[model samples]
Target: MKVLIVGGAARLGPHVIRALEGEHTLRVTDIVPVETQHEFQQVDIASPAEVHGAAEGIDAIVNCSVEREGRRRAAFDVNSRGCYNMMRAAVSHGISRVINTGPHFTIQGNTYTTFDYEINPDVPPHPSTNPYALSKGVGQEICKVFTENHDVHVLTYLFYEFRDHNNPTLRGDHPFAISWRDAAEAIRLGLEVDLATLPSRCEAFNIHADLPHQRFSNEKNKRLLGFTPQDRLEAMWQRR
Candidate 1:
């Protein structure tokens, strides 16, 4: 597969690149230059033209792009409009598979935060009014709509905390924390899964390591995408 990774220079992009590097040919793009062996393009995903150009000749798209802390216009441009541009490009090129990523709050917001257990990804998204969450929530909706109307099949991976697998001593308090490698693996599975196996054209999964905290469920990821976290992250919660 020839994959185009938007925002390929960002924090999570490298992990994803590493995960898919040897198995698939890659074309990485970002606003700034990226130093990599794979094909690179300077693309601001908010621009429809640039996104379309980047989508050219790629078999699939992995949208790692995001705008976390910025003004409303910038956030919407990247998170909301950027997603619209990507879907349009996919439709134009007849690309059927796309992997979209965002924070877990895009699906599970304040409404589910108060709940103690079994907060799954299938619930209605509240997203509250937080700029990042709202923008990302809108992006997910755009993907859903595109899937409904087009041949495109979108698998959205929602994540929270990310832990470096090498840092054994580091532990996060968040119930949804996952090792970087495990998160990347989830994206890989999303890309490879057979479209016919999916229950719908668009599906969302909460990507996280196996943790004792039942606040969020990874069952969908396991059953649908066949994702199994290599890093259980037990040390994070276990007492010495």
Candidate 2:
């Protein structure tokens, strides 16, 4: 399969890139290029003109861009409207799937709220009242709308705390923790699944590692995608 990863130059992007490498033909696009090896295309996803231009020959698109700090509008623009733009382009390009990266807080409470909660794809969203969290929640809904109304295949992965790539560590016992490797595997499996039986023509899954205390449930994802992540926090810690 040919995969296109948008905002592929960011911190979390490399993990997905590494996992998909050699298994699929990969194309990368971002506003800037951190390295020069991959096929880099500079694109502003918020711009319809740019998205349409870059949607050519792409089988699927993975959104990995996060907004800059203090740029709430840009955050919504890219994370929310930008997602719609991707789906629009996907339809135009006859893309098979649209894999959208979602925040763990799409299920968890906001920073101001003390309610610690876990979510399954079956459960509805209950986000803490924060702008970022709200935006992500809306982003999930946006993908759902695109799938239902447009018959597009949209897959969402709710990832919580991501570990450092270079020198990884587990600060505390957080149930929402997901290693980069595990996150990548969840995405790969989601991409590999047969989407014909999905209820909404769109699917969403909770993406996380096998932690001692799971803030979010993985039963639905496991049943649907047959994903059992190979890495664990303790093992990763021992290796470190």
Candidate 3:
């Protein structure tokens, strides 16, 4: 299986790259030059031509792209339009699967509310004032729309922050975090899962190492996608 990773030079790129290495054939693209040795394409995903050109012949694509916070126009272009262009290229090329990184803050309000129930993927994303979150939410929606119109299987992973490699403890201040290794594994599963077996062609998942607060449920990651993080933040912290 050949895979293309957009924004593959970003902070989380190397981790995803490491997880899929030797498991599949790989290609990488980003606005700037990708640092690692695998075949690299300097691409601006918001540009349809560049995305289509980069996507040619790829079986799968994992979008690790995100614009820096507070840059409103850049964020919309990269986060929203970028997803649109990728799906356009994907559906055109007959690609089977696409994985997008949607921000966990898409439903920013859910995190602060005192709801007795845990937040799950089924919870609608509450409108957010934060530019970054709003843009990413739009991106996820675009993925869903494309999936509805095309034969592709789209999976969006709402991520919070990457945790420390050696110490993946749940800090009291932070309710969500995923170790780099776990984050990578999740993408691997997202790419391999068969859409025919799923209830829908499009789905979004919350990605994080298990937290004791139970603020978010990752049951879908385990049951639907076959991903179960090895490190539980609470368990790792208790040993210390």
Quick one: best TM-score, which candidate? Answer: 1
The residue pairs found clashing in candidate 1 are none
Ranking by TM-score: 1, 3, 2
Single out the weakest 10-residue window by summed lDDT for candidate 1.
165-174
TM-score of model 3 (CA atoms) = 0.92
lDDT per residue for candidate 2 within 33-96, as digits (tens), equals 5574667788888888788778788887888876645578977887777887888888888886
What lDDT does model 2 reach?
A: 0.74
Q: Give the TM-score of candidate 1.
A: 0.98
Q: CA lDDT of 70 in candidate 3? A: 98
Q: Which ten residues in a row have the lowest lDDT in candidate 3?
A: 108-117
Per-residue lDDT tens digits for candidate 1, residues 19-97, read: 9998999999999999999999999999999999999998999999989995898899999999999999999998999
Task: TM-score each candidate.
Answer: 0.98, 0.88, 0.92
Where in model 3 is the C-alpha error above 4 Å?
107-116, 168-173, 235-240
After superposition, the stretches of candidate 1 with alpha carbons farther than 4 Å from their true spots are none
Poorest stretch of ten by lDDT in candidate 2:
110-119
Better of 1 and 2 by TM-score: 1
